[model samples]
Structures are given as structure tokens and as C-alpha cells.
Target: MGRTGGKGLSLARRLYTSRILGLVLGLLCVSVAMYPLDPPAWVWAVMLFNGLVWPHLAYQWARRAKVPYHAEHRNLLIDAFLGGFWVAAMHFNPLPSATTISMMAMNNVAIGGARFLLAGAAAQLLGVGVGLVVFAPALVPMTTPAQLYACLPLLMLYPLALGWICFRQAYTLGLHKRELLALSRTDSLTGLLNHGAWKDQLEVEFERCKRQQTGAAIALIDIDHFKAINDTYGHVAGDIVLRQLSKMLKQNLRMADVAGRYGGDEFCVILPDLPLFNAVQAMEALRERFSFLVYEQNPALKVSLSIGLAALDPAQGDATRWLDDADQALYEAKAGGRNRVICCSDDKPRREVFDSV
Candidate 1:
């Protein structure tokens, strides 16, 4: 159920209505369960007045300020104030009404018991405070010390239970947030880091390389003549090629390596704590895998990759330089011939000649 907040009606209205129904039903249960313990008529009158006043004020406030209330915010100010009213009203009657406070706390737990625990605890505490204020005179008039001491436990217990429940809910919410963050950083198609996520990861990897006094390797990969494949066959065939290439890279890479799609047919691999020799070996494995993969559309037609690799110098202090060098090496590979790996080193010309057919 929903309602409008200066827009079309939202499901918030239905949800709000349902919460109200639950609250009313809970009160009815408490009333019935505490049978023969009815409070004075004056106490009922005060509760009736409060039932009208608090909701009316809340509705007017929601209307004027355009607050959206639903299950999520069901225990917001209005609900808290109403729950407080229950405590104070019960003071006048002092019927067996502990259930009201318990019900308010339970309502929050039903929605997301962990995420909104603090708010629920706060609400419960507010109810406790109201009960104290309402029962102050009653406490003074009690003839026996046992009677006063008996009520003391409930005063402390309500908020304590609420606090524990809220803490559990909050811890669960934190775990869920972490899971969501990981999913957001992952690429759905290639099972690699997305471009934006890769940049952040590269920065961390670069820092780690600098601190550990280790060299890192960056490889830029381009599927050779990918556009021709898409043009010749349909997009489905093109998608199959991309998926196959991604699978080849994943299968060939080591556990420490990270791969990401740099956009279009280009992909980047970050090899942390790797020297030039090992990086070359990894690229060789990828090339070998590519050579063996049979295209589903045409097994006779071969597919290949052009790769550029560069080893980073810790003294350079620029991760971007390594990527530029690798990109330049890739450009050379594509120019000389595809299906080859080229290296970029200061001592070398940053190029490797590939034999083109």
C-alpha cells in the first residue's frame, strides 16, 4: 500500500494502513489477554483523546511537510509519540499493558530487525520514560516496598531487550552493505572488475607495489579485427567471441592477477608483484589458449589477440606511465601484426615485430 507525497499515490499509503491495522490488533490482543484487569473509564477517555490527537497531528504534519511514511519509517516521530502516549495513558489506568511497548518494538523487527534496531530501541526507551513519568505518583503511594521493587525490573527490562535486538539488526545491515558494494564493483559479463572499479583497484595495487619494493606488470589486450567478426556474423556471434576470450583469459591467469575490460574489445590485466619474465609467461599462456579456441560460428576461421605489456618502475611514481607504455606496445603489436605480445622497457625500443600473413 502507498500514498502520494505531492506526486501520484505510492505504496506507502497501503503499508501505513497495514501498520496501523497491526497496531490496533496488537492493542486488542493486549486488552483481551488482560481481561478483568480493566482500567478506569477516565484512563480509556485519555487514551481515546490521545489516539485522535497524535494521528491527526502526524497526518497534518505529513501533509504539510510532505513526509513519506511507510514500513521503513513506520516507527518515526508520530509512531514514537503514539507509543509514548500508550505508556502515559496506561499510567492513568495501570492495566496489564506491557504488551503495547513490546508490540511497537516488534513492529520494527518485522521490517528489517537489524537495520532499524537503534530507532526501535529509541522508541522503546521513549516508552519507558513515559511510563516512569506517568507512574511517578503511583510509585509514591504504594504501601509496600515489594510492590515498588517488583515494577523496577520491567522499567529496566523493556529498553535493555530493545537495545540488544537493535544491535543485532545493525550488525546484519553492515554485512549486507558490504555484499552490495562487492556486487557493484564486479562486471556482469566478464566476471572481471568494471572500468571504474578497476581504476580504484589499480591505484591500490600501485601503492602496494611501491611499498613492497616489487615490480608490477600491466597488459593491454585487444581482440584483433573484432569489428570484422561482428560485421560478418550477427551480434550474438560477436558476444560469443567476447565471452570465449574472457573465459580464455580467466583460465590462463594466475590467482594473484586481476583483469578488467577497458571498454569495447580492449581489456587490461594487472599483475601485482610480478616481474617482466613472469608477465611474459602469462601472456604466452593467453596467446596459446586463443590459438586453440575454435570459434563456434566457423572453426576454420581463426581468432587472435594483440597484447602490450610494460613493467612499472617504483621510482617513476606514476602508475599511468606504465599503462601508457603498455598501450604504446599494443599499438606496435597491432601495426606489425596481431596475435603477438610486445614489451615496453627503457633499454628496449618498446616494440616487438610480429610476422603478419
Candidate 2:
């Protein structure tokens, strides 16, 4: 079935189980409270129906309704009403009366919050009024020891069960929230960090390096002749190449390294605590590995990467300046020749050291 239908079914099942447990305990407590008064046979029959048959009837009614949620809510109100009726039948014995009313109130609040809780309380009062007319209106004002002891099980175990259910719901919602956040930050195509998320990480890494006075490097990588590949071999084959490059990066880089797709045919990397030479070596390895990839769609198609490396420099003012340094090096790598790595040196005129493949 659909998600809403499934949720309705689950809620119905939960209500059914809780009703069985609650009614059984409630019947026991009420029976103990009314034993001394010698309740009639019809009263016993009604107790049997409420405690034994009503849970099943409520389940069937809710499951068959157009909206099980609404049906179950009505059933909960009925439970509160019946609890008040029983309280009146027992002449409002202190322990049994309080247990029945409090349990029903807790159920109403748990299911539908404060508004429904108030509504259920109103329903209970209506039942009490009806009982006062049918039965005696007097209050017992005292509970025997047996009635108090009988209420102990419902008071203790019911709350624990309700608390567990609420905790499970909270934990499931937390898991769903975390999954959504991960999807939001990840690229759908490459399964890597998207442009915005990667930029955020770059800023964090920049601040970290500045605070710790440690070395780190950032690289900008572009697929050489990517548009030509797309035109000649089709975009599908170009996508395969991009995915292969991302896979290679994941496999070759250290676990601490952060990588992302900057945009079409371009990627970015943050190598924290790594020197420029080491970053260049790592990028060169990735480039060589990606070059060896053979596409099944077009065996004749070949691709290469041009990467630019820049180390964290004290002279740089902020993360943007560091990114600008890497972009300048990338421009130099493309200008000198494609399929090469260019490292930017910290100097007035910014010298580039080119590493050829």
C-alpha cells in the first residue's frame, strides 16, 4: 500500500495492542474496587465486553474506516468515556478512579497532543454525568488496599510501554533527518560533494590551517578536451569518464582528504596537512590512473586531466584568495599545455612549476 495507508495500519495495530493491555488492567482494578458493593450480573457483562471484546471491535472499526487515524482517535475518546463510566460505577474509589482517568489522558495526549487531550477529558466528563444519572451520584472517597494494589501494574507498566513507543518514533525521525542532510550535501551524478558543499568545506579547511599554522594544499582539476569528447563520442561516454575520475579519486586519496565536483568537467580537492609536492604527486597519480580507463561504448575514446595545486600561504588574506591562487595555476596549466600539473609558488609575480605527464 501507499505510505499513508501503511502508517494508518501501523497506528491501528499499536492502538489495538495498547487497548488490550490497558483494558485488562483497568478491568482488574475496577473489579477489585466494586467487589465489596456486589455489582450486578449486567455490570459484570459490561465489564467483560469493555475489557475483552472492545479492543478487537475497535481494531476492526478503525481498520475498515476511510481514515484509520480519525477512527482510532474516536476509539480513544470512547476509551476515555468508558474509563469515566467505570470510575462512576465504582463510586469514584480514589485509587481505581484516578488510575483509569490518568491512563486515558496520557493516551490522548500521546496520540494527538494537548487539544485532543482536552477533548478526551470533556468526553470523560460527559460519561461521568451519564453514569451519575444511571448509577448512584455519591463518592466513596476512599480506596481499599486491594484496589490500590491492583492499580500498581497499570500505573507502572503502561507508562513504560508508552515511553518506549515515543522513543522509537523519535529515533526513527532522527535517522530520516540525517539521511536527508547527507543527500542535500551530495552530488546526484558523481555521489561526491556538490559545488556549494565543497566550497563550505574549503572555508573550514582554510580556517583550520590558519589557526593551527599547519601546511595544506588545494587542487583544481579539469578534464582535458571534455567538450570535444562529448561532441565526438556522445555525452553518455563523457559521463562515464567523469564517474571513472571520481571513483579513481576516492580510491587514491587518503581518508581525510575532501573531494568534490566543482562543476561540469571540473573537480576540487582539499588535502589537509599535506604539502604542495605531496598534493601534486597524489593528483598526478589520479590523472595517470584515470587516463588508463577504457570505455566500452567507444574503445577509441581517450581522456586526460589537467590539475593545478596551491599550498596554504600566510600571505593569503582569506579562503577566496587561496582559491584564486589555485585558479591562476589552473589557467597556467591549460595555457602551457593540457594533461599537466602546475604548482603556484608564493611570490610577488606568482611563478608556476609545471609537471608534465
Top candidate when judged by TM-score against the true structure = 2
Candidate 1 per-residue C-alpha lDDT over 1-357 given as tens digits, one digit per residue, 9 for 90 to 100:
233365312324333444444444434433333223365676555554444444444444444444444423653534655665555544423332444555565556654466665676677567657766654523222123433343444444544554555566688779989988877887777777878888788888888888887878889999999899888876777788778878877877888888888888898999988888788778877876787788756776577888898887755567777778889889988987688888876346545443333
Each model's TM-score? 0.65, 0.91
Total backbone clashes of candidate 1, pairs 3 or more residues apart or in separate chains: 10
Off by over 4 Å in 1: 1-68, 71-161, 164-172, 297-301, 346-357
Instruction: Please report the TM-score between candidate 1 and the true structure.
Output: 0.65
Write model 2 residue lDDT over 1-357, tens digit each, in one string.
223352377688877888888898888888898888898899999999999999999998888777888889899999989988888888988889999999999999999999999999999998898878879788898888888899999999888888888787789889999999889899888999999999999999999999999889899999999999999888998889889888888989999899999999999999999877788789888877777888888889878889988889988999999999889889888887888888885543566565654
Clashing pairs in 2: none
Question: Which residue pairs does candidate 1 place in steric collision?
Answer: 1-11, 1-14, 2-10, 2-11, 2-12, 2-13, 2-14, 3-10, 3-13, 114-169
RMSD of each predicted structure: 7.8, 2.5
lDDT of 1: 0.65
lDDT of all the models against the reference?
A: 0.65, 0.88
